[model samples]
Target: MELGRLLLLQVFCAALDAGTTWLMWSRIDISVVLARIAGAFLAAILIVLFCRRAPEFRGIGRFLATSISLTCLLVSYGIFALLMLRNPVLQWPLAFAAASGASLLLSWIGYWRARQGRVSG
Candidate 1:
């Protein structure tokens, strides 16, 4: 897949995830857009690193992945905030964990499908 198309896909996924997080949370955080954009950028960098396109930038790719991961955590936190609104005194650590886990599962499914297409093509 072309890098440009991959980046677009990443942005699309991030945007959809962020939008869902907003709807689920009942509040919009402007920063989530920035985070999503940053996440997409970092995802591109991570791809380059993971694919071994640049050995010197491996550390940078790691940093980018860490940054994107942190942003993803924040996105999960936003979703958790939305989920907790239904119950005032609910502890959110577990909810966030579950949400993150679900998101990861979905991502893995999408990644698997994408890889299959690439391999079969």
Candidate 2:
């Protein structure tokens, strides 16, 4: 049941992210669409793997993971969108850096939270 919920949340987030990206660009490029699809696929796989490995991530821990992950994803996407709007040439590198940084920070937070939860209860 927890895994189901987590997977559902992942699907929702991925859909929202892709939809926002599509809406942001006036003219949709095939490369961008393909990239988003690939990213979404990878994210889904990661979520499934994490859920399987870290069964302790439930209740408040799960909530924290979901909220932080979603927030970071949106923020990263927003940064990318803003960069693309301002300066197209440097968008890819900067956006990738921002996304990568957010991912690392969020992963650490989730791991710490899960460990703390396990220790406490």
Best by lDDT: 2
Model 1 lDDT at residue 57: 24
Cα lDDT of model 1 by residue, 48-68, tens digit: 444354233222333443334
State the C-alpha lDDT per candidate.
0.46, 0.54
Candidate 2 lDDT over 70-105, as tens digits, reads 555555555555665577676454555665466546
Q: TM-score for all predictions?
A: 0.38, 0.46
Candidate 2 global TM-score: 0.46
Q: In angstroms, how far off is 60's CA in candidate 1?
A: 19
For residue 9, model 2's alpha carbon misses the true position, in angstroms, by 15
Quote model 1's TM-score.
0.38
